[model samples]
Target: MTDPNAPVTVTPADDMPASSAKAVQALALKHLYIAWVRFQRRPESMRSFIGYDLLYFPPPYAAKWAKPFGYIRQAASTIAAIRRHKPDVLWFQSPPTFFAHLLVAYRALGGRRLKVVADCHNMGLDPDVPGNFWMKIPGTIPALNSFDVVIAHNAAVGAKAAGLGVRSDRLLVLETRPAPLPVDETAGDPVPQVILVPCSYHDDEPIEMLMEVAARVPDATFKLTGNLARAQSKNYPARAPANVQFTGYLSAEAYTHLLTNCSLVIGLTTGEGIQLSGANEAVGAGRPMVLSDTQLLRSLFGDAALFAANETAPMAAAVQDALSRQGELRQASRTLKDKRERRWRLQAEACLERLVP
Candidate 1:
């Protein structure tokens, strides 16, 4: 219905419909301006048309042997980039880490006018976790308090933030949204695989539980993907489970192939963090999931996912249940996919309207 060569029309803030709020307009303008600045600095970064100018600061060191200064340098570069871009809202993907503190310092110095939003990806409640130590300390708690808004991925995380003395009103729960599943018409041969396990080197992830489950279900084949650390990959539990097969990290195309063909996805992590991105991707691809029953996980997936209590025998039982009821779970997975997509779109729209109006 439209001409391909015609210029795209964007309504001006003043001329926008009355339904749009002034706050939304201001927010949108701020983000657009920031996006423009980012484009000027590195044009390639603008490929994704998401409204906010997101600057992700990856952790500094992978191993204990690495010097701390290298991480500090990376943090400094991130801060410098933010300063140059001068975004209206500075959204930190996962705060309470060392790199996040660097960002906090940058915001404190001269970026006071910036509307800072700290997006908490993990539950910082447990004292044993590395980030929790900083979160618990008196000085560190107030440091995080400076942000205008604290965005929690799930209700459990929001509660944790509140317990840490974060203002209840400022804590917004924004769950992670799965990317649209790729359509593959080829329809590869079905392997009848019951479980998919995506593993990383992180200790918090319940890899041991997965191994236990794989051992328990002799008839089921477990496909493990994602890069494992040298030690983890080398010494992976091999003797007990002939059904377990490690395929390392798959390319997007290959991963999609597996997702399209797999019966169920499973993860057993102890940390109160919400389901990892892979879990959302699996659900989006219409794969039933058996995840840990942490507060964050329960909040995000609700009853849509089969949950195990405290990362042990119950987790294996949940996985078995998902495997047994694959048909119903598959239908539930599709419903969840639809619900999550709608929620994500609404949240994104709200965020965009707030920034761009």
Candidate 2:
């Protein structure tokens, strides 16, 4: 049984076993990363290169009324973890931007000499723009501006932080690289599969358009992953082709199996300046991809994925093209993984340099 009193630390990424220990020893900085959420692959993978000891504190209760109490417990636990670890560099995942506010208060009141950094996601960077009332609380921007360094997913997100008064040099652009899930040893499904990962069922994703694509390609199975309720609440199609299947809310094991066995992974979004976690997953698994054609996606994916417009015809065409050239696109994905991993190392190292005295 896991000990409730003990501090929870992240295990090293399977792909980069030496990353945490080696980087910490070479840099001579003890780094500790804290998050209020259950789990996120971005921080998990980033810790592999950045060598930060991860401390995850998932909320204690599910009830909405208990959130305030949950935040109080989380704040106390965060302070306890920091005191126990005594890291020279403290990194916090913001949007719970209040955690950063708490850290700043902790430094001011407690007079701790720790170098504070924030890994700001899009919502955290601009809560006002997203209009997420819970996150658009007072001091959101000021707390963000107070961080010693801000790690952004891309230059576009970093610019938002800068506009809010964070110093330019202190803002670092570091994209997410999802760690691959371990595929089962058993044989894959006999029918060819194409996965479409729409995690949030947001406005930008063309959920209805997927039905059109599935109709066009009747031979290959089309599986969509994420919450069924959210999809249904949105403009999701009531009826899809026989080949279209919704693998709603998959277990980690099932998700890994489905992603690994699929011939192609398609994650299309019209949202500007956002990076797709699904695209990163495709790269991690070395699966062929069909992604939306946007500046951010095109820049990050390059020749690795088939780019398509959000319309039915173009998306269907791209899906077909990726399915036909699975072998070639799979190899390209592997190659892209290598190139991105190398780039991530440099980017992580550069961000670390700013933390050094």
Candidate 3:
């Protein structure tokens, strides 16, 4: 197994045909991926899609007062890591879009020929921070436009970047599709179970609506995964149905087991033009899913997942529907996974051609 910390050096696959010489050449390009996120699926998945040396800087939890200091420490470490790696291409995630800006300035001032790519999440594009003037002034637009390429999750998001002055030619729409997860066939709940994976009590997640939906479906157990204390502080529903269980936070292995063995997974969000990571996890596990009804989701998922509005009644109904048709939905999910993987390959290859050429 390739070490995640080591510099990326592509070795031609044993089974790779000679005709794939161009692919081998592209994969051989040196790459270093940097991210300052606590958890993300895109960087992890990118390792398999395209080779990269992942320098993941998971910032330690800090109080609001100490957050700035935390960024300072992480920034120092990131600079050292990049200088040591000295890669041909530098790809990084943008939520604190400052990271992208920092790299752009670094490349300019240090006189390095490094090509920068910004993988902008939805929040990275539009920070949605209420009344934050900094987000509006000299925000993501300038930082994004500075990159050699900017990756968006979908065309809708790409359009947003284009509207904000990021050149269309530099934008690539690359969805995050996780690698297939190992299922624990022996692990399962005695009662019918539904797993709700939220992206940390974001405003888009309708926690109260889900709680009500759980109350409606008492026969099925509902397990919510995340930091429960954070959820509570965010004013998420304090009281839940007897069937509802807060799983605090789960380890990666435990989380995968829960998703793979669950009767259904529900990924609900009120945000427009944003894809839920939880839904991707459900797809990775080939588990049935009930996702929020939105054009972006419908277009991406097609018939693989059940759609429901964020309202309580519709969501409850969808959950019940998914539980009943678990087998059919599971098959559909597998089919969707195959289709998405093919699509991702074509897009990734096109991206590599540009980067490697």
Candidate 4:
């Protein structure tokens, strides 16, 4: 007889039917590759033992290029992995529109013991975005509800998901916090007059407005760096203003180097609820920041960074403000670094509690 208080073990049964092997294994499906790196850095409780799918599926970069059958092939392999390994829990990342349909169908209809989870990164993803036909299916919402849990980055984002008919009880908020700085507090002095603008350029970001702001502040060069900037290079309004430069997607070393050495960092966005990833990198590097004015950014940054309305004029003013008050902004960066050090681990722990069973 199985002891209720005893430990559980998964013994390989190769000779057993393939289906039966899954009955013994406890795994975590990592189809949402982007979430893997974040979760990997968390307390081991949130760590998953297994992973599947491409290791490099950054949004719009690969997903946008993938043909329908390509997605089908990707989903097929992931499903096969889950059915074979039969993970105790499967965690998916943002835009949760991928592979979830099949898994929900299988879990609802099949007697699989898997408990599925979808973690939303608040990259300003909306299931209702037009032309995203997959999200419109009648079954999609129901399928998402069928998952054991849906972890949102914040309450506002959770509300967005809930509006799509998902139960509030199924949606949990895991506040996103800044990552720890890569360098020590006493690293080399920052470069003078170089403002680094880090962006993923998710839809609705004011890239052109930033360029205009760059044009207005020709004295301080605005370095736009990321995949989004590179992807939109062909459509850039004009030869970038004399002071604006795009550095393409950066290597970690390059990104860290730039973030650590910049005079200021700019992370502008349109989502009122979304937290920008660049904000975390800025706080970690102890660099002053200029973020678009939004309740979410304001709460996270408090007095640590400058805020600007999405308008070109206000954004330009914010940059000029940061430039004028470099001393105060530098102090704010120190304060933010301290706060991030104190709060990030706690925040990460809390998020994991909701994420893992």
Candidate 5:
């Protein structure tokens, strides 16, 4: 995260010829016509894909009494978008318990012509706890049956989907992969001391634990980046040690710069569904990581990461170990980066072919 105190500057894109600009604009329009349908039951918020012209369906409700009606309104809006956009593919991030029934409605209304894909980022439920057996309720079962394709973020999630009766051919395991680190390694001396913790500061997140660890590792400065408004509104703990700084929201380039220079990365999410993009970015940049002992983290990093139990003492120890053996960790990080790049490229190609063919 850039120092909030530092002066921010705007840089223009390199000059492009008139012909090239026109060609690029035309290509964007063609892709725009081939929209990707997304069902966002939550209120308008800055998610990762905010810039994309994907359809959003915000669940309605100001009071607890109107929750059910709000969901119905959102589902109706989702159906309307599907009919209007008629996207080649219907991609859902995950099935929320309150809105899973909407999938069945979409399939019935949109018909079999549109391909339905469920991108499973976690096991069919919350991350910290094992999935509730009752999630196999009838409402969820039919919704799972509606998808033409199922994409899991990891092999474990793929297996879980299969166990829930999704066919093997329909399931695609696309592991979270990091974008290539920028080639310009011109970050100056002393590295401006930064450590990034990216994720929502929700209750399940081990924010307090991380804060304790940060307090212990005073030498390595820490920076927290994510939805700061939500954090503040939700009353998330604001007592981060004096050394820790918060960067509300950052542009892609700014965040990437911090990741490149940061000495280490730390994540303490408990959700099995939590995919650690920052961890992958850290690995790509050959930086050491200290992560919580969640199933998703274990599968993604294997033995490459320094893992600790949720408690503060163990978490602190893991961070210390990562800092101590930084060299070995950096080498392991490079190996993971190579493997992820190849896997993601292959998966992306396959997805594009399926969409455009």
Candidate 6:
């Protein structure tokens, strides 16, 4: 247990255990740390935690398996990070996969002083990506108990985490935040040929339904982003139709450009504990949204979004309706700006509150 009397410090790292490769860590060292360097230059320094410009120390050689070797090496770096910074609370975002188990092992083996808060960002059951029993304890859901608090982005995910043994009080529900995306109120006019769908192509996304929707709404083209691999098609057994274009990975400028100019942004996700980044982007840019009927999106978007059942015919109808009610939907999207603008601050403040005096 962390010492209550000790100096409270909080820090967030892109610490997804499963995917934290040396190459990925290098990006954090360069991009994330470099951004911190720039932020500190302005003098109104963030008060919660004192961290080095560089966040992660990836191991030199990549190992092939998960066990005492790969697991212990990753845990050691995280342990070392805690000891060096001596944070009362360390906020690790996502993948209860390895890190959560690591923390449990750390505490049982040696670590006890730092409080671990697992920010279960986009955390869900993820039936598609089965955990390897060969990896010793499968996925990260079992690691929820180690954390003092389990932060979930949506209530559906929070409930899932609760089912995994995280106490109710320990579960904090933070909404999908509004990003610093470019906005264009009068976008997608005259040449409204695009309907943007932002997805990671996970199993949770119903690609067959998307294909059917595309065929139904032939007037507007569907542009899907997220650089998601087409191999995910193996999950649905349905290929994307002709009108649907996959631009794959997009740069920040390109993403903003696309979102700003797109006619309708569709959040056609099929599960919970996920984000509609594309829908959020559409809202920011004052573009109408056709969202999947999930409690989370409904709560955030309210009447602003055109709610569609996660099916072919209904979703297609919703898309058509959005096209017809473009003016009203645009107004609704603009109204969301007030809500979206405050999200980043609210999320930041909520996290900061955990790192108290």
Task: Give per-residue lDDT, candidate 6, residue 15.
Answer: 21
Inter-residue clash pairs, candidate 1: 24-357, 25-357, 26-357, 27-355, 27-356, 28-355, 28-356
For candidate 2, lDDT tens digit of each residue in 293-347?
A: 8887999897699998899999999888877787788778888987887777767
**Residue ranges of candidate 6 with Cα displaced over 4 Å:** 1-89, 106-115, 122-142, 186-192, 231-238, 272-275, 340-348
lDDT agreement with native, every candidate: 0.58, 0.74, 0.74, 0.61, 0.59, 0.59
User: What is the lDDT for 237 in model 5?
Assistant: 42
Best of the two (1, 3) by TM-score:
3
For model 3, where is the 10-residue window of minimal lDDT?
10-19
Q: Report the lDDT tens digits of candidate 6 across residue range 1-357.
A: 322113332232422121223323322221111111101110112221122232433333433454356545556656666665654555554443566666677778876566566655453333323231322346565566556666776667667666766676567766545443455554446375788887666557777788889999888888877634443445432376778887766764677778777778898776654556566667667888888998778877875998978888889999998888877888888888776656544554554344342
Best by TM-score: 3
- TM-score for each model: 0.72, 0.82, 0.89, 0.73, 0.68, 0.67
**Candidate 5: RMSD to truth:** 8.2
> Residue 32's C-alpha lDDT in candidate 2?
87
| Candidate 1 vs candidate 6, TM-score winner | 1
Return the lDDT, model 1, position 193: 59
lDDT of 3 by residue, 109-224 (tens): 86467878788788776544222233454656777777778888888877877777788778888888655675443443325465555546766778888889988988887888
Tens digit of per-residue lDDT, candidate 5, span 202-277: 6557776777888998887888888676566655446778878778767656776787777678877776656666
Residues forming the 10-long window of minimal summed lDDT in candidate 1: 35-44
Whichever of 2 and 5 has more TM-score, that candidate is: 2
**How does candidate 4 score on lDDT?**
0.61
TM-score of 2: 0.82
